[model samples]
Target chain A: MKKSINKIVMIGAGNLGTNLATAIHKSGYQIVQVFSRTSESARKLAKKTNALYTSSLDEIYPYADLYILALPDDAVLGFLKSKKLNNFFMVHTSGSLPVSVFKPFSNKFGVFYPLQTFSKNKILNFTDIPVCIEGNDKRTESDLMKIAKNISRNVMVLSSEKRKQAHLAAVFACNFTNHMYTIADEILSRKNISFDLIRPLIQETSEKVKLMKPALAQTGPALRKDKQILSAHMKMLAKDENYKKIYSFVSKSILSKTK
Target chain B: MKKSINKIVMIGAGNLGTNLATAIHKSGYQIVQVFSRTSESARKLAKKTNALYTSSLDEIYPYADLYILALPDDAVLGFLKSKKLNNFFMVHTSGSLPVSVFKPFSNKFGVFYPLQTFSKNKILNFTDIPVCIEGNDKRTESDLMKIAKNISRNVMVLSSEKRKQAHLAAVFACNFTNHMYTIADEILSRKNISFDLIRPLIQETSEKVKLMKPALAQTGPALRKDKQILSAHMKMLAKDENYKKIYSFVSKSILSKTK
Candidate 1:
């Protein structure tokens, strides 16, 4: 097995795959091939990296030093079971899946999970995005770490269990947090208020967490336990049962955490 | 009433009050006095703004152009009721309360709500903070807008009802969003992972909404309707009922908003 990973095959041209391939390629690594279920996705990503594109698994470049499976968790296992191209060092970029998933498929494998939300077309600096790495062996681990270090300054070796926990935490912090913003947008739209008005508040709230513990940084009517304001907000949300439920549930949750 | 508000009295020395007083003072307004329930609180904020400190409502400067009741919503009314210093134009910084809350106390009154979370020690730039202004009359609105514009580049005249809705939206956007971070912290701590791992994701989530509608920026297993990953995350949260409830509730909320 090669200890130094130079040439790469990205097996999924999705959001993570596209961003990872582009970033890795930009860092002077050779992107040998790009593969996706759709030729359009493969072509689009391949064009950015100046690499070949393919929609079929059989068409993937087998000579690359590494194959990055940036597919969904299920697809990762499915792809491995479908093919026996285990000559290269393999890694699946999944938060929940373990490095052991590649045990039956490849003798040399690891997990290279970049822990960040990636949306296609959004320009991102991969320098600070946390890349969680785990390998079945020391050489495989070192190879994975080499690629990860080249792309990110924030990299850690996390076990599958720990990585999964971080993933669960991210779902709350990123996904659910965005949902809160969406609800706020919905609420503001009802009153014809522009979402721009609350952008600073949202920005400050996120910025505060970076500086202090989130619990210590929390501020609002709920944390204040202002019954008057809480009830007033609940009444305002009364028209929408879902929002009302959310407001009450989250408020209660906050109150419960109060010391 | 004066069309220009230069001399001001700040009532309350809490997070919002201290920050607002300092910002307003720094903007060249003369903060004549600072009041708080605790003398030490009043004195500390007073020292920053070069204003007199008072714990008693009776000691408040009666001749200032504006009496900013940066107190709690109830305290605003309480202070007004407890004193008849209605000669000056009055304004309260609150999201939920309407300008009419001051109708019984003074004719020259308005709402000067700076829509951002403020920490007492954290230095913040008020230049971009949205200042929602509402006044009882044209002259009062003009006066409040004058002061607001002095401190913030972003200022708007929003009606009481609309301001209340905006406040409601802010509770969701800021308060609830922070709670999500707290929950994420809890989840991460269980596996001994640093909170730093998810900061980039959280920061990006907030950054995305500034450029795009949050609903469009949403990415996760819930939004993607990946039942397998969703079930796995739910299982991970199974031990903590509150966290589990929050996880399932928010994931469902995200799914409901899905295209």
Candidate 2:
């Protein structure tokens, strides 16, 4: 078996791209080139990975075995349209965009979506992270799997439509859930309570769902039909009509589910 | 200092009561007696803890040093009204009720609130759990702290009103957050998508808030003002008014905060 994929090129040196480059480099892959709209970001990542950095896509090294477009979803298609090339294997690390966007560029196209929210400073463990991969062909699929497996222990092949559904779910699970936490923070701050008070409960709620289906694991005043507590909470959130609506809507949903 | 509080007499065997008794027993404390309204539940927990069980409050052993009242908020006052006790340090593990609830029964009254959600099968780590304690006097505070420190590393003496506020925050952080997960589960299930797909993202959202304030850590299409994606999600949830309202309200709240 081949030990690893050696030559790689990365576009967009933002959070996801930088983290992916760092992980790939740490796994002993040679990052051949780095391209970003910003020279500073590209140069910083290049210096860390010992890769050649260029602001221009025209200066990109063409010989790299795998090229990754880690730009935003809207920007990815534009970047692909401008760069006219590639019989080589290429993939985008996006959860929402369709895989067929690469159809115009290369036959050896796929997706390498690491299903986790990435931020600039947060260092994530890729070992257990689900890397959803899909390829245009069998050989490309095999190659993507091999590379994905090298960087992560969990990898699965999912169709583009399924990946799109997963992205929608990710929005609810990660992004929307974080918004709920922010709501809690705001509510607590207004009442002069520390956010630390809710940290353990948040951790346990997540941990519980891992053991049971989230629906079965669900518990609260809503599920228990504790109208007193529910009304009290609603009154507390009265100033924020948006939060009040969420509180009532979710409570009713939970009540319906339990019934 | 005594290495452990050996003889524990639990005064209520409801959800919190049974769970806390089991946790304390598992942590090597001897649960000497289980007291509750229902003999069946008391016997069930007593059998698990190898302790004597009784439904009659008068049958409770007078020798136990630590008495935990884990009954419902409304029931605590009634339980105290019925029980005549003296010379024993009593702690009610509740976030909402005041320490004065136990003042009529024992001068050594304190609150020993385990700041996490509890269920029958879900075993929790007491070491990392924050125990919010409040005492009527210094000796009671010291006794409660000693007991709390035995089970958990993090313990704080918060006022009863502050603890009430913390409980209110918990409604948002734990209860309402889990409700969001339920909504997400329902959304995916309706789409014929597996909830497992969003598990990683759900876990990451909670984990992220541990390191950064949820307000600073917020991210979503809402924060970016990506009306296209937001509209797409809303359309998908259009048939379900509950979900549509939730999506719009939460998105607007997040966007307002970002601005």
Candidate 3:
């Protein structure tokens, strides 16, 4: 039987970090410490999780078995490189940052990437969230898996290279797709149309992908080769050069994929 | 009290048309007739709805109180322009096609655009879906509203111009967003990562926007202004110029919006 992850120390009380801390606490793990660049963030999360808070990195207590570097991907490496591991297992919850980031610091290096787009206000259901994990060794991997399984149901022991690829995919799936929503919102705002009108379709589009392959499920004027409607839409979008450019580019891309 | 819409005749059984027929049927409205250029499509929809189907445009039975032209935007104008009105209330379920398309056909001309992306296999909930309607006059508008309210809980009486803008927004929200999903799926496939991992994030990202403005809810390396991770992702995507361009474009776009 695997042992439970009793205590966890989260570094970086930003959106992902704060949410993860709360989720961990809710999952019955005790958050031993919360650290952030700002005192307010550290204190806020500490209050919520009943964990010790500190703005200073050196003041971090090594009471916990695991340390999660939930800072920005760039900051994660330097933060890891700056500190000596003190023989405790450390993992960075970053998609873009590599597992090798903690190589020089400790042999017990790993990644615990929660593949989800999170916000401070929105509570996420970690049950369905995919936890992509990696470790330098088998023991470290097993330890991280036990921790991950506690918080999330879906856990995958992926290699560092595979994690990198998954992160890149996340950029497209989460970041780029959100950008598309912003564009849609902007277009609606400009026309005095309510953004709420498109909300159902946006939700449905995401839901459909859960059951079907995106390629097989793709639909639009572009895929239909409706030159007339495309031309009319282009004419309608004549004033907005950027949107017109995007329409042409995406239409061409979808057509290429369909072909 | 509004009379129930029992008879619905659908013109142009393409993607939108076929789906609308299915939706109307599922919503307890009787699809009396289905017309299409292709015999196969008309037959398929007719079989699904248990309605009379015809390939010849002239053979369209005027059995329904409501005629829905789920046709291509341009085809709508040409089709309606040639037809003589027989006092039947007609509406084109189009976002781009102007209400003027129905001017020559009937004074009861209006629009019943169920603002959504519909595929044959994917079942949609009409209750939450917005039905953007417009009419040539007040009586027709009221009649159209009655029809819309019968199928959907959320119905809005939008002007022709507003519907056009909504269409543009739909392109951004539905069509373009789906394209982004396609891009994400492609990126993940190329990297040998299952697209399933990012599904939760994609769903959450949209769900977040329902309660919060997309600009405020957006969370990504791009919005965080993390240059290091951004550059790292760029480096990884160096070989794929298309993805690289998209990353840079969307990152810049999102940052601009938040700023």
- Winning model by DockQ: 1
Q: What fnat does each of the candidate structures reach? A: 0.84, 0.67, 0.75
lDDT of 3 by residue, B64-166 (tens): 7788888876677777765633567788888877788666556677889999888866656688889988889888788878767877899999888888878
- For model 2, residues A159-243, the per-residue Cα lDDT tens digits are 8877776777777777777877877787678777778878888999899888677777776677768676677777767787888
lDDT of 2 by residue, B1-259 (tens): 6433579999887667877788788878899999988999899889978999999878999888788888776677777777655657688887777788776677677898988888766656688788899888886687778777877888889898778767777777877788777777766776687777778778888888888998777766787687767887788777887778778888887878776
Off by over 4 Å in 2: A1-6, A81-89, A104-106, A188-194, B1-9, B23-32, B56-67, B77-91, B100-108, B184-198
lDDT of 3 by residue, A1-259 (tens): 6454588898999888888899889888889999888999999989989999999878888767788888887787678666644567788888877787676778677888898887766657688899988889898888888878988999999887888778777887778777778888887888777778888888888888888888876877888787877888899889866667677778877787777
- The CA lDDT at B140 in model 1 is 84
Chain B superposition TM-score per model:
0.95, 0.88, 0.90
lDDT of 1 at B197: 89
Off by over 4 Å in 1: A1-3, A84-88, B1-4
| Interface CA RMSD, all predictions | 1.0, 1.8, 1.6
> What's the ranking of the predictions by lDDT, best on top?
1, 3, 2
Where does model 3 exceed 4 Å of error?
A1-5, A84-87, A235-242, B1-7, B26-29, B62-64, B81-88
**Over the stretch B86-152, how does candidate 1's per-residue lDDT look in tens digits?**
7568888999888888877777888999999988888688999999999999988988888899999
lDDT of each: 0.88, 0.80, 0.81
Q: What is the alpha-carbon lDDT of model 2 when measured against the actual structure?
A: 0.80
